[model samples]
Target: MLIDIKGVLNLWGSFVRFTDCKGYPTMQAFMRESPQEREKQRYLPRLDDDTLAKVDRQIRKLDPAGKAKAYLANLAKPNDKREELESLESDELQFAILYLRYVAGLENKPIWQKLSLSKGAFENELRLAERFVEGVLIGSEIRLFL
Candidate 1:
Protein backbone atom coordinates (compact mmCIF):
# COMPACT_ATOMS: atom_id res chain seq x y z
CA MET A 1 0.00 0.00 0.00
CA LEU A 2 1.14 3.50 -0.75
CA ILE A 3 1.65 5.49 2.48
CA ASP A 4 0.34 9.01 2.62
CA ILE A 5 2.63 11.19 4.75
CA LYS A 6 0.26 14.13 4.41
CA GLY A 7 -2.43 12.88 6.89
CA VAL A 8 -0.58 10.19 8.89
CA LEU A 9 2.33 12.28 10.09
CA ASN A 10 2.55 15.58 11.93
CA LEU A 11 5.39 17.87 13.09
CA TRP A 12 7.52 17.19 10.03
CA GLY A 13 6.73 13.43 10.15
CA SER A 14 8.82 12.92 13.27
CA PHE A 15 6.32 10.71 15.09
CA VAL A 16 3.03 8.80 14.56
CA ARG A 17 1.53 10.06 17.87
CA PHE A 18 -0.17 6.72 18.63
CA THR A 19 0.97 3.19 17.87
CA ASP A 20 -2.51 1.59 17.50
CA CYS A 21 -6.29 2.03 17.62
CA LYS A 22 -6.04 2.86 21.31
CA GLY A 23 -5.56 6.56 21.83
CA TYR A 24 -2.72 5.99 24.27
CA PRO A 25 -0.06 8.62 24.39
CA THR A 26 2.80 8.33 21.94
CA MET A 27 3.57 11.99 22.14
CA GLN A 28 6.87 12.97 23.73
CA ALA A 29 4.76 15.39 25.71
CA PHE A 30 3.87 13.43 28.88
CA MET A 31 1.44 14.16 31.64
CA ARG A 32 2.90 15.10 34.98
CA GLU A 33 2.00 12.78 37.87
CA SER A 34 0.33 14.56 40.74
CA PRO A 35 2.58 15.09 43.76
CA GLN A 36 0.23 13.05 45.92
CA GLU A 37 0.42 10.06 43.56
CA ARG A 38 4.19 10.23 43.14
CA GLU A 39 4.65 10.40 46.88
CA LYS A 40 2.24 7.50 47.38
CA GLN A 41 4.18 5.21 45.03
CA ARG A 42 7.55 6.17 46.44
CA TYR A 43 6.78 5.45 50.10
CA LEU A 44 4.47 2.45 49.64
CA PRO A 45 5.74 0.05 52.26
CA ARG A 46 6.34 -3.65 51.78
CA LEU A 47 5.61 -6.24 54.47
CA ASP A 48 7.30 -9.60 54.95
CA ASP A 49 6.63 -12.49 57.31
CA ASP A 50 9.61 -11.70 59.50
CA THR A 51 8.47 -8.12 59.94
CA LEU A 52 4.87 -9.04 60.74
CA ALA A 53 5.50 -12.16 62.81
CA LYS A 54 8.77 -11.78 64.63
CA VAL A 55 8.03 -14.82 66.74
CA ASP A 56 7.60 -18.10 64.93
CA ARG A 57 4.77 -19.00 67.28
CA GLN A 58 2.94 -15.79 66.62
CA ILE A 59 3.01 -16.58 62.93
CA ARG A 60 0.99 -19.70 63.63
CA LYS A 61 -1.28 -17.92 66.12
CA LEU A 62 -2.00 -15.05 63.73
CA ASP A 63 -4.79 -16.86 61.98
CA PRO A 64 -7.83 -14.67 61.35
CA ALA A 65 -11.10 -16.39 62.22
CA GLY A 66 -13.14 -15.70 59.12
CA LYS A 67 -16.63 -15.79 60.55
CA ALA A 68 -18.72 -13.48 58.44
CA LYS A 69 -21.67 -14.21 60.66
CA ALA A 70 -22.68 -11.82 63.42
CA TYR A 71 -20.92 -9.10 61.54
CA LEU A 72 -21.69 -5.52 62.54
CA ALA A 73 -22.31 -6.84 66.02
CA ASN A 74 -18.79 -5.72 66.77
CA LEU A 75 -20.12 -2.18 66.83
CA ALA A 76 -23.83 -1.87 67.51
CA LYS A 77 -23.78 1.84 66.89
CA PRO A 78 -21.57 2.05 63.81
CA ASN A 79 -22.30 5.77 63.56
CA ASP A 80 -20.94 6.42 67.04
CA LYS A 81 -17.22 6.87 66.35
CA ARG A 82 -15.99 6.60 69.93
CA GLU A 83 -18.16 3.58 70.64
CA GLU A 84 -16.93 1.93 67.50
CA LEU A 85 -13.34 2.15 68.71
CA GLU A 86 -14.39 0.95 72.14
CA SER A 87 -16.18 -2.02 70.61
CA LEU A 88 -13.20 -3.26 68.62
CA GLU A 89 -10.72 -5.73 70.07
CA SER A 90 -7.27 -4.43 70.84
CA ASP A 91 -5.76 -5.68 67.59
CA GLU A 92 -8.59 -4.35 65.48
CA LEU A 93 -8.53 -1.05 67.32
CA GLN A 94 -4.82 -0.76 66.70
CA PHE A 95 -5.32 -1.31 62.99
CA ALA A 96 -8.13 1.22 62.96
CA ILE A 97 -5.90 3.73 64.64
CA LEU A 98 -3.23 3.17 62.03
CA TYR A 99 -5.79 3.71 59.28
CA LEU A 100 -7.00 6.93 60.87
CA ARG A 101 -3.42 8.09 61.10
CA TYR A 102 -2.83 7.32 57.46
CA VAL A 103 -5.89 9.34 56.50
CA ALA A 104 -4.46 12.21 58.54
CA GLY A 105 -1.31 11.99 56.37
CA LEU A 106 1.00 10.68 59.04
CA GLU A 107 4.06 8.70 57.96
CA ASN A 108 4.89 5.18 59.13
CA LYS A 109 7.16 5.97 62.07
CA PRO A 110 4.96 8.67 63.52
CA ILE A 111 1.81 6.62 63.05
CA TRP A 112 3.40 3.66 64.81
CA GLN A 113 4.40 5.95 67.66
CA LYS A 114 0.83 7.20 67.94
CA LEU A 115 -0.31 3.61 68.32
CA SER A 116 2.46 2.90 70.87
CA LEU A 117 3.59 -0.13 68.88
CA SER A 118 6.99 -1.20 67.66
CA LYS A 119 7.38 -1.84 63.95
CA GLY A 120 6.98 -5.63 64.08
CA ALA A 121 4.09 -5.61 66.54
CA PHE A 122 2.28 -2.95 64.57
CA GLU A 123 2.57 -4.86 61.30
CA ASN A 124 1.55 -8.12 62.98
CA GLU A 125 -1.55 -6.73 64.59
CA LEU A 126 -2.41 -4.88 61.42
CA ARG A 127 -2.56 -8.17 59.51
CA LEU A 128 -4.72 -9.90 62.12
CA ALA A 129 -7.00 -6.91 62.45
CA GLU A 130 -7.29 -6.82 58.70
CA ARG A 131 -8.55 -10.39 58.66
CA PHE A 132 -11.03 -9.83 61.46
CA VAL A 133 -12.35 -6.72 59.79
CA GLU A 134 -12.68 -8.59 56.51
CA GLY A 135 -14.84 -11.22 58.17
CA VAL A 136 -17.00 -8.59 59.82
CA LEU A 137 -17.41 -6.62 56.62
CA ILE A 138 -18.21 -9.77 54.65
CA GLY A 139 -20.77 -10.84 57.20
CA SER A 140 -22.43 -7.45 57.12
CA GLU A 141 -22.32 -7.39 53.30
CA ILE A 142 -20.59 -4.07 53.53
CA ARG A 143 -17.87 -3.42 50.98
CA LEU A 144 -14.50 -2.01 51.89
CA PHE A 145 -13.59 1.18 50.03
CA LEU A 146 -10.45 -0.42 48.74
Candidate 2:
Protein backbone atom coordinates (compact mmCIF):
# COMPACT_ATOMS: atom_id res chain seq x y z
CA MET A 1 0.00 0.00 0.00
CA LEU A 2 1.20 3.48 -0.77
CA ILE A 3 1.88 5.39 2.47
CA ASP A 4 1.79 9.14 3.01
CA ILE A 5 5.11 10.43 4.23
CA LYS A 6 3.62 13.70 5.48
CA GLY A 7 1.01 11.94 7.61
CA VAL A 8 3.50 9.45 8.99
CA LEU A 9 5.92 12.21 9.88
CA ASN A 10 3.16 14.18 11.53
CA LEU A 11 2.09 11.19 13.62
CA TRP A 12 5.68 10.45 14.60
CA GLY A 13 6.22 14.08 15.48
CA SER A 14 3.12 14.11 17.65
CA PHE A 15 4.24 11.00 19.50
CA VAL A 16 7.69 12.45 20.05
CA ARG A 17 6.19 15.68 21.31
CA PHE A 18 4.01 13.81 23.78
CA THR A 19 6.85 11.69 25.12
CA ASP A 20 9.22 14.65 25.26
CA CYS A 21 6.77 16.67 27.33
CA LYS A 22 6.59 13.74 29.74
CA GLY A 23 10.44 13.96 30.19
CA TYR A 24 11.09 10.92 28.03
CA PRO A 25 13.59 10.68 25.18
CA THR A 26 11.30 11.82 22.39
CA MET A 27 11.48 10.76 18.75
CA GLN A 28 13.70 7.73 19.17
CA ALA A 29 11.71 5.84 21.80
CA PHE A 30 8.27 7.34 21.90
CA MET A 31 6.21 4.37 20.68
CA ARG A 32 8.93 2.01 19.52
CA GLU A 33 10.00 0.70 22.90
CA SER A 34 12.00 -2.51 22.64
CA PRO A 35 10.49 -5.78 23.84
CA GLN A 36 12.85 -5.82 26.80
CA GLU A 37 11.89 -2.27 27.73
CA ARG A 38 8.23 -3.09 27.33
CA GLU A 39 8.68 -5.96 29.76
CA LYS A 40 10.42 -3.62 32.17
CA GLN A 41 7.66 -1.01 31.89
CA ARG A 42 5.09 -3.07 33.80
CA TYR A 43 6.44 -2.02 37.14
CA LEU A 44 3.81 -1.68 39.86
CA PRO A 45 4.04 -1.98 43.60
CA ARG A 46 4.32 -5.62 44.64
CA LEU A 47 1.17 -6.92 46.23
CA ASP A 48 1.69 -9.86 48.52
CA ASP A 49 -0.43 -13.01 48.40
CA ASP A 50 -2.03 -11.97 51.66
CA THR A 51 -2.98 -8.64 50.18
CA LEU A 52 -4.53 -10.35 47.20
CA ALA A 53 -6.57 -12.62 49.42
CA LYS A 54 -7.70 -9.66 51.51
CA VAL A 55 -8.87 -7.74 48.48
CA ASP A 56 -10.69 -10.83 47.24
CA ARG A 57 -12.54 -11.11 50.53
CA GLN A 58 -13.38 -7.43 50.54
CA ILE A 59 -14.74 -7.61 47.04
CA ARG A 60 -16.83 -10.61 48.01
CA LYS A 61 -18.35 -8.55 50.81
CA LEU A 62 -19.07 -5.46 48.76
CA ASP A 63 -22.57 -3.96 49.22
CA PRO A 64 -24.37 -3.24 45.95
CA ALA A 65 -27.10 -0.84 47.09
CA GLY A 66 -24.70 1.19 49.15
CA LYS A 67 -22.57 1.44 46.06
CA ALA A 68 -25.48 2.79 43.99
CA LYS A 69 -26.20 5.47 46.53
CA ALA A 70 -22.57 6.35 46.75
CA TYR A 71 -22.22 6.43 43.00
CA LEU A 72 -25.27 8.68 42.65
CA ALA A 73 -24.39 10.92 45.58
CA ASN A 74 -20.90 11.31 44.30
CA LEU A 75 -22.00 11.93 40.72
CA ALA A 76 -21.69 15.67 41.24
CA LYS A 77 -18.44 15.20 43.15
CA PRO A 78 -15.02 15.43 41.59
CA ASN A 79 -13.17 12.24 40.74
CA ASP A 80 -10.66 12.61 43.56
CA LYS A 81 -12.84 14.36 46.13
CA ARG A 82 -15.01 11.41 47.18
CA GLU A 83 -14.32 9.31 50.26
CA GLU A 84 -11.92 6.51 49.63
CA LEU A 85 -13.52 3.05 49.69
CA GLU A 86 -10.34 1.15 49.01
CA SER A 87 -6.96 1.78 47.47
CA LEU A 88 -7.46 0.63 43.90
CA GLU A 89 -4.45 -0.98 42.33
CA SER A 90 -5.52 -0.20 38.78
CA ASP A 91 -8.67 0.13 36.64
CA GLU A 92 -10.03 -2.73 38.70
CA LEU A 93 -10.45 -0.35 41.60
CA GLN A 94 -12.74 1.80 39.53
CA PHE A 95 -15.27 -0.96 38.77
CA ALA A 96 -14.95 -2.61 42.15
CA ILE A 97 -15.85 0.58 44.00
CA LEU A 98 -18.91 1.11 41.83
CA TYR A 99 -19.96 -2.51 42.47
CA LEU A 100 -19.75 -2.04 46.20
CA ARG A 101 -22.19 0.87 46.14
CA TYR A 102 -24.60 -1.01 43.88
CA VAL A 103 -24.74 -4.06 46.12
CA ALA A 104 -25.10 -1.94 49.24
CA GLY A 105 -28.79 -1.30 48.82
CA LEU A 106 -29.59 -4.96 48.33
CA GLU A 107 -28.66 -5.97 51.81
CA ASN A 108 -31.69 -6.15 54.13
CA LYS A 109 -29.98 -4.06 56.77
CA PRO A 110 -28.19 -1.95 54.21
CA ILE A 111 -26.07 0.92 55.38
CA TRP A 112 -28.28 3.41 53.52
CA GLN A 113 -31.72 2.66 52.02
CA LYS A 114 -32.62 5.99 50.50
CA LEU A 115 -32.27 4.83 46.90
CA SER A 116 -33.67 1.76 45.17
CA LEU A 117 -31.89 0.17 42.25
CA SER A 118 -33.44 -2.41 39.92
CA LYS A 119 -32.39 -6.02 40.53
CA GLY A 120 -30.87 -6.21 37.06
CA ALA A 121 -28.90 -3.07 37.65
CA PHE A 122 -27.61 -4.43 40.93
CA GLU A 123 -26.50 -7.70 39.27
CA ASN A 124 -24.79 -5.82 36.49
CA GLU A 125 -22.84 -3.84 39.01
CA LEU A 126 -21.73 -7.05 40.70
CA ARG A 127 -20.65 -8.46 37.36
CA LEU A 128 -18.61 -5.35 36.69
CA ALA A 129 -17.00 -5.67 40.09
CA GLU A 130 -16.18 -9.29 39.38
CA ARG A 131 -14.54 -8.36 36.10
CA PHE A 132 -12.52 -5.63 37.78
CA VAL A 133 -11.31 -8.00 40.47
CA GLU A 134 -10.41 -10.57 37.83
CA GLY A 135 -8.43 -8.00 35.89
CA VAL A 136 -6.65 -6.76 38.97
CA LEU A 137 -5.67 -10.27 40.00
CA ILE A 138 -4.53 -11.27 36.54
CA GLY A 139 -2.65 -8.03 35.93
CA SER A 140 -0.89 -8.19 39.28
CA GLU A 141 0.08 -11.80 38.83
CA ILE A 142 1.40 -11.33 35.32
CA ARG A 143 3.46 -8.28 36.28
CA LEU A 144 4.31 -9.16 39.85
CA PHE A 145 7.48 -11.03 39.01
CA LEU A 146 8.47 -8.66 36.26
Candidate 3:
Protein backbone atom coordinates (compact mmCIF):
# COMPACT_ATOMS: atom_id res chain seq x y z
CA MET A 1 0.00 0.00 0.00
CA LEU A 2 1.10 3.57 -0.71
CA ILE A 3 0.06 4.79 2.73
CA ASP A 4 -1.48 7.94 1.29
CA ILE A 5 -4.93 9.42 1.93
CA LYS A 6 -6.55 7.16 -0.65
CA GLY A 7 -4.85 4.14 0.91
CA VAL A 8 -6.09 5.13 4.34
CA LEU A 9 -9.64 5.55 3.05
CA ASN A 10 -9.43 2.12 1.39
CA LEU A 11 -8.77 0.69 4.88
CA TRP A 12 -12.39 1.38 5.83
CA GLY A 13 -13.43 -2.24 6.36
CA SER A 14 -12.54 -4.39 9.37
CA PHE A 15 -9.18 -5.82 8.38
CA VAL A 16 -6.01 -3.94 7.41
CA ARG A 17 -4.24 -6.26 4.93
CA PHE A 18 -0.69 -4.89 4.70
CA THR A 19 0.72 -5.27 8.19
CA ASP A 20 2.09 -8.13 10.38
CA CYS A 21 -0.32 -7.65 13.22
CA LYS A 22 -3.56 -9.22 12.10
CA GLY A 23 -7.12 -8.53 13.27
CA TYR A 24 -7.28 -6.54 16.44
CA PRO A 25 -8.03 -9.29 18.97
CA THR A 26 -7.49 -6.70 21.65
CA MET A 27 -6.67 -3.02 21.46
CA GLN A 28 -3.98 -3.72 24.00
CA ALA A 29 -2.21 -6.01 21.59
CA PHE A 30 -1.94 -3.15 19.15
CA MET A 31 -0.51 -0.78 21.71
CA ARG A 32 1.87 -3.20 23.37
CA GLU A 33 4.67 -2.92 20.83
CA SER A 34 8.02 -2.24 22.40
CA PRO A 35 9.83 1.04 21.82
CA GLN A 36 12.56 -0.81 19.98
CA GLU A 37 9.97 -2.18 17.61
CA ARG A 38 8.46 1.26 17.20
CA GLU A 39 11.87 2.70 16.46
CA LYS A 40 12.39 0.03 13.85
CA GLN A 41 9.20 0.94 11.98
CA ARG A 42 7.89 3.92 10.12
CA TYR A 43 4.42 4.62 11.45
CA LEU A 44 3.15 7.67 9.58
CA PRO A 45 3.34 8.13 5.84
CA ARG A 46 6.18 10.04 4.31
CA LEU A 47 5.16 13.66 3.86
CA ASP A 48 5.08 14.82 0.25
CA ASP A 49 6.64 18.13 1.14
CA ASP A 50 10.06 17.32 2.53
CA THR A 51 10.13 20.55 4.51
CA LEU A 52 7.04 19.40 6.42
CA ALA A 53 8.55 16.09 7.47
CA LYS A 54 8.81 15.13 11.10
CA VAL A 55 12.26 15.34 12.62
CA ASP A 56 11.50 13.44 15.84
CA ARG A 57 11.00 10.10 14.09
CA GLN A 58 14.65 9.30 14.70
CA ILE A 59 15.35 6.07 16.61
CA ARG A 60 15.36 6.35 20.34
CA LYS A 61 15.65 3.73 23.05
CA LEU A 62 13.52 4.30 26.07
CA ASP A 63 14.11 2.51 29.37
CA PRO A 64 12.26 -0.80 29.63
CA ALA A 65 11.09 0.25 33.07
CA GLY A 66 8.98 2.95 31.41
CA LYS A 67 6.94 0.56 29.31
CA ALA A 68 3.94 1.07 31.49
CA LYS A 69 4.39 4.79 31.33
CA ALA A 70 4.65 4.70 27.56
CA TYR A 71 1.62 2.48 27.30
CA LEU A 72 -0.37 4.80 29.50
CA ALA A 73 0.75 7.73 27.40
CA ASN A 74 -0.42 6.29 24.07
CA LEU A 75 -3.54 4.47 25.19
CA ALA A 76 -5.75 5.89 22.47
CA LYS A 77 -4.19 4.40 19.32
CA PRO A 78 -5.24 0.98 18.01
CA ASN A 79 -5.48 -1.38 15.06
CA ASP A 80 -8.92 0.04 14.26
CA LYS A 81 -8.90 3.80 14.48
CA ARG A 82 -12.59 4.55 14.72
CA GLU A 83 -12.44 6.60 17.87
CA GLU A 84 -12.85 9.87 15.99
CA LEU A 85 -15.69 8.64 13.80
CA GLU A 86 -17.33 6.99 16.77
CA SER A 87 -17.11 10.21 18.70
CA LEU A 88 -19.49 11.95 16.31
CA GLU A 89 -23.08 12.43 17.38
CA SER A 90 -25.55 9.78 16.24
CA ASP A 91 -27.08 11.84 13.45
CA GLU A 92 -23.77 13.23 12.30
CA LEU A 93 -22.24 9.78 12.17
CA GLN A 94 -25.21 8.52 10.20
CA PHE A 95 -24.99 11.30 7.66
CA ALA A 96 -21.26 10.94 7.35
CA ILE A 97 -21.58 7.24 6.65
CA LEU A 98 -24.43 7.72 4.22
CA TYR A 99 -22.59 10.44 2.36
CA LEU A 100 -19.40 8.44 2.05
CA ARG A 101 -21.18 5.24 1.05
CA TYR A 102 -23.69 6.77 -1.31
CA VAL A 103 -22.84 10.27 -2.37
CA ALA A 104 -19.17 11.15 -2.24
CA GLY A 105 -17.98 9.74 -5.53
CA LEU A 106 -20.94 10.25 -7.79
CA GLU A 107 -20.65 13.17 -10.16
CA ASN A 108 -24.35 12.97 -10.90
CA LYS A 109 -27.15 13.50 -8.44
CA PRO A 110 -30.35 11.52 -8.87
CA ILE A 111 -31.94 10.50 -5.60
CA TRP A 112 -29.83 12.62 -3.30
CA GLN A 113 -32.83 14.48 -1.96
CA LYS A 114 -34.26 11.16 -0.85
CA LEU A 115 -31.54 10.94 1.76
CA SER A 116 -33.26 14.01 3.27
CA LEU A 117 -29.97 15.43 4.41
CA SER A 118 -30.00 19.15 5.07
CA LYS A 119 -27.40 20.76 2.83
CA GLY A 120 -25.73 22.63 5.69
CA ALA A 121 -25.76 19.66 8.05
CA PHE A 122 -24.54 17.11 5.53
CA GLU A 123 -21.71 19.24 4.28
CA ASN A 124 -20.71 20.22 7.81
CA GLU A 125 -20.55 16.65 9.00
CA LEU A 126 -18.82 15.56 5.83
CA ARG A 127 -16.06 18.11 6.28
CA LEU A 128 -15.77 17.20 9.93
CA ALA A 129 -15.45 13.54 9.09
CA GLU A 130 -12.87 14.34 6.45
CA ARG A 131 -10.75 16.24 8.95
CA PHE A 132 -11.17 13.52 11.55
CA VAL A 133 -10.06 10.78 9.16
CA GLU A 134 -7.13 12.88 8.05
CA GLY A 135 -6.04 13.29 11.65
CA VAL A 136 -6.33 9.56 12.23
CA LEU A 137 -4.27 8.82 9.13
CA ILE A 138 -1.70 11.39 10.12
CA GLY A 139 -1.12 9.77 13.50
CA SER A 140 -1.59 6.14 12.53
CA GLU A 141 1.21 3.65 13.10
CA ILE A 142 1.61 1.20 10.22
CA ARG A 143 3.03 -1.69 12.25
CA LEU A 144 0.23 -1.40 14.78
CA PHE A 145 -2.44 -1.64 12.09
CA LEU A 146 -3.84 -5.02 11.14
Pick the lDDT winner.
Answer: 2
The parts of candidate 2 lying over 4 Å away from their true place are: 1-49, 53-115, 142-146
- In order of lDDT, best first, we have 2, 1, 3
**Could you report the Cα RMSD, in angstroms, for every candidate shown?**
21.4, 18.7, 14.1
Instruction: Candidate 3: list runs displaced more than 4 Å.
Output: 1-7, 10-114, 143-146
Model 1 spans > 4 angstroms off: 1-92, 143-146
Tens digits of per-residue lDDT for model 3, 56-110: 1210111123332233223336637423221334433443343334333332132
Q: Give the TM-score of candidate 1.
A: 0.32
Each prediction's Cα lDDT score? 0.35, 0.39, 0.34
Worst window of 10 by summed lDDT in candidate 1: 11-20
Candidate 3, lDDT over the whole model: 0.34
| Error in Å for residue 80 of model 2 | 26
- Who wins the TM-score comparison? 1
Which window of ten consecutive residues has the lowest lDDT sum in model 2? 35-44
For model 2, the local distance difference test gives 0.39
Question: How many pairs of residues collide in each model?
Answer: 0, 17, 1
Clashing pairs in 3: 16-146
